[model samples]
Target chain A: MNKKEQRDHWLARPATVKRIWRVFVALLALTVLAQLAVSIKGYFGLDGWLGFGAAFGFLSCLVMVLFAKGLGYLLKRREDYYGGKEEPADDV
Target chain B: MMFEPIPPALALLLGGALIGILRGHARSAIVLLAPLATLWLVWQVPDGVALDIKFLDYRIEPLEGSPVRRLFATAFALMALVGGLFAYRQAKWHELAAAHIYAAGAIGVCFAGDLITLFIFWELMALFSTVVVWCGGGPAARAAGIRYVIMHLLGGVILKVGIEGIAVHTGSIDVQPMLASNFDAAMILIGILINAAAPPVSAWLSDSYPESSPTGSVFLSAFTTKTAVLALILLFPGEPLLIGIGLFMVMYGIIYALLENNIRRILAFSIVNQVGFMVCAVGIGTEMAINGAAAHAFAHIIYKALLFMSAGVVVYRTGLNRCSDVGGLFRTMPLTAICGIVGALAISGFPLTSGFTTKTLISQAAANEAMVLVYFLLAAASAGVFLHAGIKFPWFVFFQRDSGLRPKDAPWNMAAAMLVFAFLCVLLGVAPELLYRFLPYPVDYEAYAPDKVLFYLQLLLFSGLAFFLFLPLMRRTRTISLDADWLWRVLLSGVARGAYGALGWIGARLAKALMRIGNRLRAVAARHMSTSPDGRRSGVFARAWPIGTTALWIAILLTSYVFVYYL
Candidate 1:
């Protein structure tokens, strides 16, 4: 409806926003349904959970994110951590 | 014409020597063709030691051929070719030359038949790659390169010591797999892991690689660590300690990658992550696992280089590489975006990509060995790989909130190089048999069985969902996460700084005391005897003792001697 709204990505032009959201939701839903396709009886003490792989993947990511945030609190520093001269900012 | 059997490494090493003299089209053609010529020689190498010499009662072999060796050599040669193409137009002749020598060194390591030859090639790779890093030609590059060489030189000394011990103790220099139960083996393993960017020293890869010029980084990404991986596969495979080491590297890479803001550093971390799979596979030591390790290394160099090339293109155009400084670039740089996305998906191990085909074999081996913890951890790491590198890299650099930058797509040469590797990434995924044929063992595995595919899709896609849903958490910050390198870069420096301060303080206090002593002596001198500042002495006996004074001294010496004799 307004420029600021578009910038904020809320109340977008309905058709475009709806189409993208529909695809994202559909794809996520498809992953859940894929569990039905593959019967995953887990080994390695992670037994007895249906669709364990999906849950594990999702939960691991959440924990890692949370851990990274906690780690960032301690380890993250202003770019000057290495004396502010490092040029390329990415780390693997 | 000179007629000597040239080593395959010389094709690139010598070619590197000629690149500067050659101009324009000749340079590009030579750079592009040198790898092919080297690859051709690589294939011509016969099984077993190709060159041998006697050295102080030990046999040193410089070249050897085997499936695993050829596999590494082939990937290195191909990396050189594609990397050359990607970089030819952008990099100066010297950078390309150094890169060629660097690639040659990696290939040299792959074919090394003995510890001595391996060490030689290893040092060559070390020296030339440092040159490539220094070729960035700025203070950061210079400093990072210095630090890089320091790490490698330390590792090199440790490696040389290990090799010497192995030679003296084992009485053989052949590059055969060994256990880490002995001091020599343990030392060798540590030496190789340092180069592999394994824990406690893993930060060197992420620390130095990102500081190189965009093109230089692509070559830096390929050679040093993977050569170390190749060394592991050859010399230390099946050592169980590597399992723990590899797991540390895997988690370290993923976590650091998550916290990193620089794009290439993220890729550097992923290199450690990818190499972890190889290292862990080597620890498995079974035929399947070793093959998996070798195969994974082959696939990794291509995709990893592709990622670097894509990032290089970004830097080449925008002069910026941080996720914080870059976003929403896909609109104009569609080709780069697509290529980058392909590299990302391949790294994430999505179905129909090279990672899917290769990385699973490692986890499968873990499961086969009934290593419950290892299996589950590997699976989780695969998901983490996707999270840190797969979605995070492309999302921030390409599709996030528009930075309103319309940088052009990668130049044709770069685009072609990326396309070639991207094609290989998909090709290997779709038809893994092509690569499996190159493995040391026969292929009897299925990568795309329905159950397996379904499970992987579930794992990977859910991780992608997590990346998006946690978008707020993934926000870039103007910060760096401290890693193992901090021990040296920060703590060691800080310690040295403190030591210097203490030393300075002691020196200052000592100087003050000396000055006070000097002033007291001067006052005494002024009271008893005096001299002009110009050295016209007006003080008593300041110039010299007279003959009479000398005779008195002799009389005192005689009297003291007589008294001592009488006593």
Candidate 2:
């Protein structure tokens, strides 16, 4: 394909095409496997399992994201909600 | 030495003055030279008091040297140099000048041997740093600068009160590292944490910094909070409460950063997050932990400045700071993209980067002390840092679906400054010993073992993995998460407005009643006056009083007076 044609084709891929994302998932799986291959000393005895590193990292991130989302529901406000006529601070 | 060297702070103070007098290229020369001069002077002093004076039955030490002091002072001066280089081409003359003064104040605090001098320099930083914010030159900048100044000034007052309390109680004012347990110490701790952007009120950093000009944020990232870190190291080391406080800030930064849309605001939150590591280390209070805090700070200033410079380049070239607005600039602005990614990786503690070398020391300290929870939390925080800043920043700004932004890379000076700091990041990573020599304590540790590197990689990469997996959940929104500052920015203002409305209503009612009473008084006066307009009223009361009535009044007054006198 011509360069422009290829650019359009790349953009035309569906959001759920799951190609690049699949590679990332594969990497994650490989890493979790690698964590098992290595004999790593765990500071917290509970975190010394086969996939503990990967699980802990993933779960911690998941929890943080969820907690942050919860915070969003309670704390998030329209950009201009602080005052009458959007407060002209930090929007710069 | 043949003669006494000038105090290091003057290099910037006087150099900035020279910049004010000179213009154009000459001023730029001073901008670049001042920090280098300061760095040179930083190394000359021996580890003892350099200047001392007595004032009103008190001794003040303005310049003193120790390993920690030299470490912080050196890093600050280096930051001034790099930040100055990044700014001189784009910023106003006054912004550069004020920044020098701001940095000078920070340097002064580093060398302050007494609390009173520390307080003086602390307020000095608050003053000129606000001026730097004001140089941003917009309505938003103006308002943010005012809020920024108010927070710092209030912090300054709180610190002053604490200092006075300590002085009165102990009859001494020497600056010493101690736990923040007593009332005076607690106040000082709170005051310093306020400047550190510690929660539950860290929003000021995010609220004000992004408002600065692109270059201004670079300088903003370097001095104020880091100075607070230095102060904490000097004043409140080993305070257990800081562990909780620092961890809260760590989580707060990550969460808010994920929710933040503005590019600079995310970076601001990350600053709080990074400083939280130092705060935690201080609480650990071991020789290794203190060493870790000081080393981490040195490395952090460089990497953080580089990150801010990258974001600044984006804001400067595109005048767009929202993550959703710009991407895919690697085609043209390759240098900026690569440097920014390097910064992100370094901040993520990726192996072979400065963050890896420095941040691990703190975690190690936790482990050595057998604080399992602190260790785990620090590890998790390291992952979160990668998620919010390490990957998220570059992904959104440089590599996400092309916003078709093909703006040129940063200007030569900005590029040069980034390159210098970026090189330092890797150099320190590859050769940790170079940085260790300057640390406050004797070094007996290694940062990069094979297992440690593996674990950090697994943690960070998995965090990245989770990031991409949960990408939908991390979508940017056009809103702000209400922080503790909301109490002042939103709730207090709302209350004030309500009070004002109530007062207006009461004022109107009061005016009406007063008018009614005034009208009645006018009516009575007319009835009593001889010059009444109504003829009947004049006949009844307003007519001239008869001499007999006047005599009766006089006789009654005289009789009462004479009876009182007799009694």
Candidate 3:
């Protein structure tokens, strides 16, 4: 690794990166587990179940990501798809 | 004699005009001071049609004040101030002028007491925002500006027709609460929806906004759709059709945003999604829903501008916009990164952020109405928001695999503007009552209930988990996602070319047939008129055989003349 990048930032450390990810995952677990203790009063019949927020939030996002990936196959095109010049004459 | 109050929008308009003429710090000073002056003037307006004048035969109220109107005007004016602060150092002088005039148009819409005044201000906005888009200064910007103006002008024309219809049919030009049940009202609703960036016609927002200059976009994001939300709250509250339309917009924004690659275009799509929440609340049309829509509109202007400002800085420094081209910027651009994350969290409705306080109100309103399906879909869309905008934006643009870019942080004025908005995002969240006091209705909802916070935390954090889990799928491709604009940009143009070609072929055949028929007719005329004894071509009167015939004709004419004289 280059010396400049080595001293660039603490976030560049592999150990520090791993530690941050660990803490983030732990927080995610805590939010889900807290739901067991506090009953979520959902207006809809199914949403009041335990971990409903976590499950619904995760699953819906999963669905959206999958849908988007599929849509990209259909709708996504090269940057110059509309025949606009590949390089903009000026930065905006 | 008492002096009449001046219209507040006039302050910004005149400031814009002066900015065009002045140079250096004087122009910058006007940019900073005009919005503050307008803000003061906005407060001076008393409720209920503060200024009325007669135009032609009709009485028009040019300045009206109500809590909601004042609230929207305050937000717009503040946006002009902060936006001017951000752009003064970098944007072209004409860009700054156009943006201020655009701001004036939005503020004008807020205080318009009658439909005619509203329509006039609406067209004014259409005129100047196009100038802002053109200020991007490229062929792409030029083309996109034309398309954007066409869309807005089309909407303006539709709105004008509807207003004229209402005036002629109902004998009134007053702005009042109404449903879109009749033809005129439906036209008005459609017109406003186009501005709101509603689906099918909504491609204009995403297509044009990202093409604008970095500073221009920060201004662009704040005004157009929010004003439409204000107009909706004022005119079409409680319209049932809005519910379905709003739901479609919410989902449509999520899908398009998820697939988007450009940093600004992603945010642009999310604007549609965010406005969807407000449109849905207006559809609900309860007091709480109206308040929610208004509050969300205000909060949205701040946070969305914050996000755009950060994106603008990234673009300004690196001269790159695609997520694929830049990353690991947080190492050098710490302030910009942090503020961007703050804006992202606020948009995701994270606890202790402005988005949570405002967005939850819309959800709660739907629940209050027992709209089970809507509430659930909104919940899903909320998670979807975090996925596309909250995590994806920051993850791709700042923290993804390094593309070896180490650009400097935001310039001082830009940083200051970001700080101001970032502070407001938190301030409104921590003490939402500061915003709530100004709502059109009395406040009743509690945003920070323990249970509500817990539920939102769980929802958003888990969505964060999904973002990581599905990170591989979102690998930025140097590409763009096609939108409804493709229909006009590609399909429509192709159809026009084909029609022209077909017409040319038919025209060639028609010309050939006409030439043949002309020749035939000329030949027949020559046979009758010019055949001589020698079978030579000659005029009938010039032929030698005509001498005897002419004498006989003279004799016959003399005889007829004599007979007529006898009679």
Candidate 4:
């Protein structure tokens, strides 16, 4: 909302956000590359392949999100689907 | 011995009673002291049937101790202590009391050596948990509590029927492992599955748990499902059906949580998913699998509660439950955010967290059995867990688009509680034996092998990648995703209303017909009996034709009868 507030907030800066993403991507790359140093024996034959964890994990999550989105078509309802007024947390 | 063997659950039960009667520092002391006392008592239980009673010609083992029993009891007691610390400053006195009572029920269920004893404590859990849900204190909470109680009570009745059937057939009620090979065992499995938050009935956990008060949910998440996992391990180990059911729950929790908008509900669904891993392990039924199940249950209780605590703090501060309503909270609430991230990491089974060491055991069990499909599915589910709970929760609630709402962080007690659990999550992760030794079986498994660590790190980090990559698909909306609860909440209710209306309509027509028939009969009788002798259509009986004339008719009839008798 103000220049001082913007400066104080680290995430508010586009440059800082870009740097964080760079680190995250680098971390992802390192994990994938570490497989070259350490051979992971898999219980199933297919899982032992290079980058299998990354491929499988990424694909599984992708499929699951898609599956959930499809399910949302059939099941999603408005927040007031139960017809009661929503209340704030009881602590308040 | 310095002390007589007592049921460890009593400490919390007594504390619950005292909290209701006491006030101020005394109440606070009891709130904090009871769970610690229970934890001390839990360790005191020897490895056997420590106490028993006879009822209806049956021996009931009210207190039994085993490694598994003690482990579950320890977790319950610990949860009560930490949860009390989290809530005492903010929650209503009765809610705290009900929560303690609820924790007592879970602890009670842990040490029960016989089916009857287990059932008693099982019902105790069901009863007081409803009170905790009601502690949420709203129309939604009230309605959710009613639904929750009805489901649990139904499960309890089914379990009772099965217990009775088993007792009648075998002439014993000992808590022994059995398969669902018969009607009795099937009933028992179904009953326990309901509590395990297994499919069809699993919706109740997601439905009611999030409706509880922020503090109330922290307690609610720990006991009921984990205790059910304990019960399943004790009674129905090696049931193959559980493998399929557990897998379903694993996926079910992930999908629903993915679609969920409310931060608390997402965590609630994750409970089902995590419990799924335990259930699946129990079905594997090896010593390794059983150990894995027990250890996972212990780890799950800590991290899941931590997640709920962090979410509770957000809700407490911002008064917002939906993820869409608030973001960028990591700025103001660094402790809460870091604790939540730790919880998220632990839940994801990241290499350095509690979930990693414990959950890997279940996957290893599947691998040991050469159940290739089960192992792969479990691995994928682990990834799914990270996607839904591990990343989705913190992302939406803490780090997504700035909602410009800056709320203060958790209060001292809450933060302290989170810190303790967060520390335990890492502590167990770094040193698996701290938990592994307490497993019912010996631990030969090593969680920190180089290959295993790399494998999990890759899987989880990649899942994290998928999360950010598919962020648009996972955006929060002001909506809820329906589950099996819809059957009773909508379909069954609609059917019930229709049946009631039909019955009312049928009864009304039947009453009208009966009245018409009665009127016809009355008309015929009046026409025959009320006509005068002169044909003047006078209703003599109805109008009360002179008392004298009536007496004269009576006399004539008596005279005629006398003449006939003489004849």
C-alpha DockQ of every model: 0.45, 0.46, 0.71, 0.74
Query: After best superposition, candidate 1 residue B138: deviation in angstroms?
Result: 1.7
Clashing pairs in 4: none
TM-score of each: 0.92, 0.94, 0.95, 0.95
Q: Point out where model 1 deviates above 4 Å.
A: A1-14, A41-49, A88-92, B1-5, B515-567
The sequence of per-residue lDDT tens digits that candidate 1 reaches over residues B1-567 is 133335799899878988978998988899989998999888888787777888878788887889889999999999999999899988978999999999999998988889999999999999999999887777787888899999999999999989999989988888998888888888888889899999888888887888888899999998888899889888887888889889988988999899999999999999999898889899988888988898888889989999999999998889896998888788778888888989999999999999999998887888889998998899899999999999999988987777878799888999999999999999999999999999998877888877777777778888988998898997899788888788887789999999999999999999999999999998888855766688865677465678998999999999999999999
lDDT of each: 0.87, 0.87, 0.91, 0.92
Q: Residue A80 deviation, candidate 4, in Å? A: 2.2
- lDDT of model 4, residue B516: 100
Cα distance off (Å), candidate 1, residue B63: 0.8
Best by lDDT: 4
User: Could you tell me how far off, in angstroms, the CA of residue B64 lies in candidate 4 after the best superposition?
Assistant: 1.2
Steric clash pairs (candidate 2): none
> Where does the lowest 10-residue lDDT sum fall in candidate 3 chain B?
B535-544
Interface residue Cα RMSD of candidate 1 after superposition: 4.2
Compute the lDDT of residue B549 as modeled in candidate 4: 88
The second chain of candidate 3 has a TM-score of 0.95
Minimum summed lDDT over a 10-residue window in model 1 chain B is located at B1-10
Model 2: residue B151 alpha-carbon error in angstroms? 0.4
